[model samples]
Target: MRGRFSQAWSDVLRGSAFPHEGQAFLEQVFSADVFRPRPDHGGREERFALTYERLRHINDRVREAGSTVPLVQDRERLFPLLAWSAVADPALFYAMFLHHCMTTGAVLEFGAGREDLADVLEELAATERVGALLMTELGHGNSNASVRTVAEYDADREEFVLRTPEPAAVKFPPAVAAEGVPRLAVVLAQLVVDGAECGEFCFLVPLRDADGPLPGVGVRPLQPSPWLPLDGAVVSFDGVRIPYRFWLRDNAVLTADGGFTDPFGSPAIRARRTLSLIRFAWEAAVVGLAATAGASAAVAVRHAHRRRTGGRFAAGRPVIRYRNQQRALFGALSGAYVARLVAAATAGPEAPALTPRSVRTTFLMKVVTDRIAERVSARARTASGALGFLAANRFLDYQGFAHSLNAAAADNQMLLLDGAQALLAGTAYTPPADEAPAAGDRDLLDPATWETLAAVRERILHQELADGLRKATGSGLAPFDAWNGLYDLAERLAETHAARLVLGTVREAVREVAGSDPVTGPEAAGILRDLLALHALEELAGHDGWYLAEGLLDADEVRGIPALLDRLCERLEPYAEELAEALGVPYPLVGAPIAGEDYVGGLAGTAPSSGTA
Candidate 1:
């Protein structure tokens, strides 16, 4: 029964989230011998070389199979492919992500409908020239709008002089320079025409060739992070000349008179559009994170079921039988499923363009999903005991990957604050309808009740922020003061909004499952619904103090959350191995010793103890 339901649940998840191309890549390329994890033999350069080798191997396999790396424009195909890579290897995933999503995506997106960029696009598609994106400066942090890199147009030469003026202007932490590969980056810089700043634009700047870093370009690799080793570097440009054709102009015109004209009259709007490619990066990231979360949970649960502990009273019981252990493992398993559902909703060919609405949603999605991945990975690592710390088990690697994302793409907290500020500025955010009578009106077990509670919290917080903002400003506080005074509320509102969205996505999956496979499907659906309740209860418990103070959840109700959570964990306990299997992570990809049938036998120089040993 467990096996049947596990297979059914796996079908429901992978069938909904991964596209055919993505599924095929995972089965064929990712499962192949070339993509397996190998021991690191040397130092930084050698590790980076191995990453590139894996990347080249995958690229070759994909090409040989008559498909190229899917760009952000084809994110439905792109995301799942990246997700599988992330499951296989973090370093390989990071390199592939940058190459396909950041670099190739920038060229294809920013240079869309332009004839001049066709050749370069082909080179990127063919993996001839590696791609990278340079946007965030060392000093500017998340403030891409304030970057000091300048591209001054020299009319006489018809070339743009790209320069990082001061120490602060150097682009930080992109793996732009590899030893033998030619690399190009879509660099964001303030464009100047005859000393007049004409907003920021992306320019295709060459960073390196076979010889070394290109003349007038500087690349200094940063200190290696042992957990996630990449060829990350700080790059600076000293008057590197960019040709006229390399400008990634979208409906912008430059004539012989040294004047620039754009459809967007507002400099702010243009700047937003210039940084729009980051949206795709966010989308790609969550998908990879979803996969990592799932893979991590799968590894932990598999290990839990096989390993035995508690010899004081019971001679040897499965570690998974403990309530505390069950919580750690199943909580992660549930979070992984929720994360995947959220990722599935966010990515696809039908994903909206860079509109105001899409921007806010995607930003929130990235921030929330980053936190989910972080929490899920941490729990998975803890559940596996000492084995989780080993690199070969992949739990530490998964945790490192998740931690890196919290800062990469964009800092998660900063993204939330920015998103909250936008929401506070009259951006359209419809609170979930007032359906459930405030708090005590519905059954706790109903998914509808959880959804309503989450929505209500978000709505109340949003309203409170708005009312406080008006009151503060009316009392003669400056605009900045008004915002800073209520900063915490705004941040909470953003987080609640994201949690609400995640809750809704998980519930949607439950309903879909409930509607399918009348026989075995109902069992899988019940398991998923329990997961949804678990996720909702977890979020609600986090804000229980707030909920109690707000008079939404009484003290008694709040106290009962732990017991309810335990019950959910207990009910789901029998299916722990099934849930892990349902995540659809390949067996080779898990590759943890304790997860195997014979844990002691799998360990090096270890044998099963005989009774008389």
Candidate 2:
């Protein structure tokens, strides 16, 4: 099994064109059942679904090409600007959930014990097969608001009988991954005990393991398209008994005695824990989008700068030089780094329990990530002009997948509202008047740590202020520049949050390490402080005039920000490669093809493109 990403990446850089099967398959993927209001040709639905199918197909090809890097790591190549189209057009998003279920390998991980599916998934994982998580039924998506599929505990038989009682309850629209005869899927259903609903959990079901379907696991395509294969449809369960351990066990668990035990402390804690896994995985995907777009911008801008303009239908010399193009590519460039910087700041392995404010802060970074991918990718297509539309070059397809991924990954507004609810929710959960630390508890508060947390709050407030001012001021600055300013502010706020978490976590790690040098620790601490100050200052500079006029800071502080920001950018710039290294695979989630060793030639003699062409 190819485990290393750098080697796996070489499979990413091959020709960006769709496969012949893929082109023939597209009409089925882009069908009316899938596209809805969007057109089948050249429209938003066509572009968005095409992008997802192509990128997913690329991952398949790359896996076949023997790239060790995970498909998630090579996201920059798979999901591009088309993600923007997904948010605007419903059709793109419609296929997104199904795409994720297929591409992500959900079924194989959770539904492993069902003999046929398990064998198929093991082979796929060993050989780089695309996988999907199939928990969301036609009856429910995020909310298990109501589920009807039953997996009855059969103690005597030593197996659970999985059954779908009604058509509405069946797993409808399992989508394209199922269309090509998939490798694996995690099927979600409720556990029944004498007609009472115990809870919901995922059962890993392998569809097309190494050979074919597991017995009793029926599979079929839903909507067909002219452009891509999006056969997300339904499947049924007729007393299909899977082994007990096939449950994901992330939240609710089945006891040996047949009772259910949720050991994550409380029902609320358990719920949050489950959501945490989902949020973390999806957030990782969001970050992947940023990394992908940033890498694409680096290459496209460099290429644009080199290419001469003014041929028939040509975008003039050096597209990035155009303010509008700069607005798109450079704006995204800043955003990806900013989001990365923020994620690093807010989330350390041992960070404090999220204050309501902290949860909102982290979740918001995810929102910005999703939104920025959508916004910038669309702009990238427009910036590329006709070239952006060509399936061979594949900017359009890349953009489409990004669009759908962002749109369906989770609704941004819903998530933002949820985060806000969680943040403000603390008041209801804890008595507001007694929330502050008690006397003598002051010693428990690490001074710098508290200051960092407080600073995070203040910094976010400042960004909110900046965004509001930008729209209110209507300064007529270019939209890209305006957004860049807003993102810089958001970026720093993100970093401030990340820095606090990392530093706060270091204290715990140091205590565990025992003899670690104190001097080195503080120096490292300084590095984190520098990170917060740097990105935050970049944000502050964008609206320095507003700050000065508003009396938020004196002229010296106002004037000093640019110098301070430049200083920080330069300092961090030197450490950028190290930063990338420190981030590990988490940083590569954005899906750009180039980040892996495959594109840059870590191993001699392998082709660099995504392998399928």
Candidate 3:
């Protein structure tokens, strides 16, 4: 048992290498997690109390590392943990970050605020800590060029006095302080260059000295976030004096004399690097949520397989006897597997090219991950029966993660539109869309992006990002079937090209790394070949409607996809455990909710610990 747990820990860490275990572990530890059925006949209320207590303990740990003091003092440890947690609960991601900055005595200039910052995080990180930055007003999220927060140079006092003119100019949804005390605030007020607004730059302003609130910084927290615990707030400035040197450089370089130097290309590019940091977080969060859902399904299946009921073959056999249960379990498991692969592969980052295809792929992958997680979790919860809804069962935990992931970010949709735009631009992409389209009519090849994907793909989106976002706005299609729809023929072509890019690189890398290995070895090179074959077969399969209209595929090759997937699943079956191991998820033994082959009795969390199965 100890060995298994250790191995499980190793597997998880191998995937993330972060300080914390994924949230899925949070649900199953000591088997006292949420979603657990009452064991030893304990009262449901008692069990729930236990679960909440467990969660609170974890939350306590989160506050400890995520607080401002921890962030400032132990930044190295804190950043990795924050990145990892983003993989788990992205909603908690930014909130915790803001909390850390406020509690740790750091200043925000463009994104977060300063008023009451110290108080809020002090409760979490300890007292007498605060920071501030009120840059993003209610008027915009990324339109920095249109910013209204003004900071004019007061040459006499040698300070920049900041002010907010209109209500929209007030930075609502900005990071703020609690208890009205702040130490340092780098406000992102528009720098009045030669009597004109010269873009935006952060200015270091002392909001509160050891005595009290500085001079002109004011704030208000958003009443509540839509889903997650987003402690959003509004902020404004009135003649706030700040000594410079607070601007996070790499974009709009500001000289001490108030002159600007933005030599690294456009301001948009530089600004995007900052957004990339958040994007990294979203990516990590989406992946983490998917993994959590996978664990939830695994647990639910363990319970379902053990809980007995009437069956066709046996007299009230295990619930796993039901086809409905298997369909739910296995289908979700497959999705979890696919999602896990995608997340692990894409979790790092992509390039900063604002190209539509790249944006489309990124957005599609996010939506795909989000949808799979939400759907699988909802199904898994139902599979757990009444126990799933109970706080003790841990289903609600997964639901919390899923709903939160679904409730953030509008950029995902924009990415999809960008993908459509990429498709329109004639970017060729083709890999396997189906196996043997037309039963070995190898002539169905489409253009592939072999060159670009082969070279540099950037370090995690060309810089920083913690990962995951929920909210879906715009066409609502992103939340609906946008991810599900088959893209245009051009899109399929792009997919084919993209798949080749990935597979080709993998094929080459495997040659160097797995020269003597099996499956990946020469003996099993067929698997890789078949995988690529399968990819190509499927890539063009989706554009059948358009393909048929455009004569991309003849009538003979259209009917082979089902067989292809069927064959692929069968071929991939023998290597499933090996592949799962390589990917770093724990094996089935550790995934059991309790302990039983049938997943019932004492193991299902319903019965007492009278005997082991």
Q: What is the C-alpha lDDT of each candidate?
A: 0.79, 0.45, 0.46
| lDDT, model 2, position 358 | 52
Instruction: Put down candidate 2 lDDT per residue, 393-468, tens digits, no spaces.
Output: 3345446545545434455555644543332224323211212233334221243433343344545554464555
Candidate 3 lDDT (Cα, whole model)?
A: 0.46
What's the lDDT of the predicted structure labeled candidate 2?
0.45
Tens digits of per-residue lDDT, candidate 1, 315-429, equal: 5888888889988888888889888877888875576766777888897898877788889989988888887777667778888888988888888888888888887776775
lDDT of 3 by residue, 200-301 (tens): 555555555445455676755455442333334677778766654333443455555666566645545544543433343344454565566555655665
How many residue pairs clash in each candidate at the backbone level?
A: 0, 77, 75
Q: What's model 2's TM-score?
A: 0.53
lDDT at 462, model 2? 46
- Model 3 TM-score is 0.59
How well does candidate 1 match the true structure in TM-score terms?
A: 0.95
In model 2, the number of clashes is 77
Best by TM-score: 1
Cα error of candidate 3 at position 238, Å: 3.5
Candidate 3 residue runs with Cα over 4 Å from true position: 1-91, 96-137, 141-145, 172-189, 202-215, 223-226, 249-261, 264-279, 307-324, 347-368, 382-386, 391-410, 418-613
